[model samples]
Target: MTQTPALQMTDVTLEYPDGRDGTLRALDDVDFTAEVGTITSLVGPSGSGKSSLLAVAATLLTPTSGSVRINGREVTELTEKHRAGLRRDEVGLIFQQPNLLPSLTALEQLVIVDDLRGKPRRRARERGAEILDHVGLAESCSRRPHELSGGQRQRVNIARALMSEPSVLLVDEPTAALDHERSEEVVTLLCRITRERGTATVMVTHDTDFVPLTDAMVTMRDGVLSASAHRGSPDAGSTRRSDRPGSSPG
Candidate 1:
């Protein structure tokens, strides 16, 4: 049987108003996809449309033209309410910063996410525990974000994203705030979770270290997509160590 694409973007374009002249194209005819049980890493220099793509995919920003689909459902044409529902039900978002509520405990964080999606808070509590454990943060459930380390906070963020068991995961610069070791650990954990949960994950980052851990690596330059040879196949544990230049030799 053929697999349904978890995400599909075809001929997508997004632009922002330039002060008094032409628009600035954030994404131009960029097409990409992530299948279930796989992770696709988007790497590029600053201003290369990486964040714009993530924003559009998360329904946080609308593209100027083209299609955005999740689990074979077209989201580009959805109303704001429907788009929000799609985001809540089908898409999971992880940001560079942990972005946790200072007042909410880790468990509360996940519980509230489900609550916001109209799911029963009690039903989500068990899922919250399961995902928190899956992400290696079972013991930190009652801790507030400030009480946890940077890496631990990020793990909570990841756990919160997965609490709904979304089919599509959108992550933006997940390792930007982490140290080298912590970043690697987070990426490895992400890869593991993507496979175990059968989530199609797309991560935007400038970190070259994670290039090897992904099922496929694609780069955006001048709002266009380009494939890279860094990732060989769609297997989760096929990483090989090599001396990547301009990368911290960790």
Candidate 2:
């Protein structure tokens, strides 16, 4: 039996008004998909539209045209309220910064997700604890943001996203603020979590060193997606570090 992709986008295009006379296309007829139990790395330059694709996939920004399906349910036509509900129920977003509330403990951060969903407090706490432990933060449950290191804080962020039990995970520059070692640790943790939870994960990163650790890598340029190559495949070399204009290759 074939499994459907956890997240799919086809012919997606997003345009923003350029001054008053023209439009700037952020995503140009892009087709992207992420399968269950696998992770895909999206690599591109700063202005190459990587974040635009992610925003569209997350339903945070409506595309000018396209079809977006999460767990096989079409979301492009849903109302904002419905789309928000779908996002909350089916998608997990891991931002570059942990942005933890200074006053909230590590576990409390995860519990808040359940609170937003109206889940019972007891069950929320239970699930939050389990997720935190899964991310190797079992002993730091009571620590607040100030008490945790950068890597630990990121782990809490990952755990918090997992609290929703989402089928799809959207990560943006998860290692931007970490040292080389911490970056590798966080990416490895993401890999393990994706496999263990069967989540379809799409991670956007400027770091090419970690791309090979993902199942597949796709390069984006001027809003267009190149063909993806699986890790260790002959064509995988095509996904080499993007050399953006006026910038050194990553």
Predicted model with the maximum TM-score:
2
Instruction: Give candidate 2's TM-score.
Output: 0.92
The residue ranges of model 2 lying beyond 4 angstroms of the native Cα positions read 232-250
TM-score of each: 0.90, 0.92
User: Tens-digit lDDT track for model 2 on 64-130?
Assistant: 9988999899999999999999989999999999999999999999998999899999999999999
Off by over 4 Å in 1: 229-231, 234-250
| lDDT scores of the candidates, listed in order | 0.83, 0.88
Best by lDDT: 2
Residue 171 Cα positional deviation in candidate 1, in Å, after optimal superposition: 0.7
RMSD of 2: 5.6
Our tally of clashes for model 1 stands at 0
Q: List the residue pairs that clash in candidate 2.
A: none
